[model samples]
Target: MIGGFFDRYCGDWSPDEQALFEALLEEQDVDIMAWAIGTQPVPERFAGDMMIKLQRLDYLPIDR
Candidate 1:
């Protein structure tokens, strides 16, 4: 999931966004997945445009 997100958006991200993503990488995978799936509340620091985009889950290839 993270890899797909990076592939789809990393190239277009600004340096700040890239840094934000890198910081996000330091978080637990389960936490990240929860945020992406909306199963848990996103912490204030991680709640913003990037998280919003992740929640969309459009980069994932699974049929819906």
Candidate 2:
């Protein structure tokens, strides 16, 4: 999937990564939730904005 410093939690990085996300969000140019859970494919059963952010960071989960 994504090539980066991903860990186990990377799969479920939604609002969970608050600290890191907040910092990134402050950057403004970066995605707030560059990682997320429950999001896959184009249209997500979860939410689009979160998915979009994750996809942008290539941090969303792959269908296992």
> For each candidate, what is the lDDT?
0.94, 0.42
lDDT of 2: 0.42
Model 2 RMSD vs true structure = 11.7
- Measured with C-alpha atoms, the lDDT of residue 1 in candidate 1 is 91
TM-score of model number 1: 0.92
Give the top-scoring candidate (TM-score): 1
Clashes of 1: 0
For candidate 1, lDDT tens digit of each residue in 1-64? 9999999999899999999999999999999999999999999989999999999989989975
After superposing candidate 1 on the true structure, give the runs of residues whose Cα lies further than 4 Å from its correct spot. Answer: none
Minimal lDDT window, size 10, model 1:
55-64
Residue-wise lDDT of candidate 2 within 1-64, one digit each (tens)? 3224244335666665545544444542322223333332332332444445555545545676
User: In every candidate, how many clashes are there?
Assistant: 0, 0
Off by over 4 Å in 2: 1-16, 30-53, 56-64
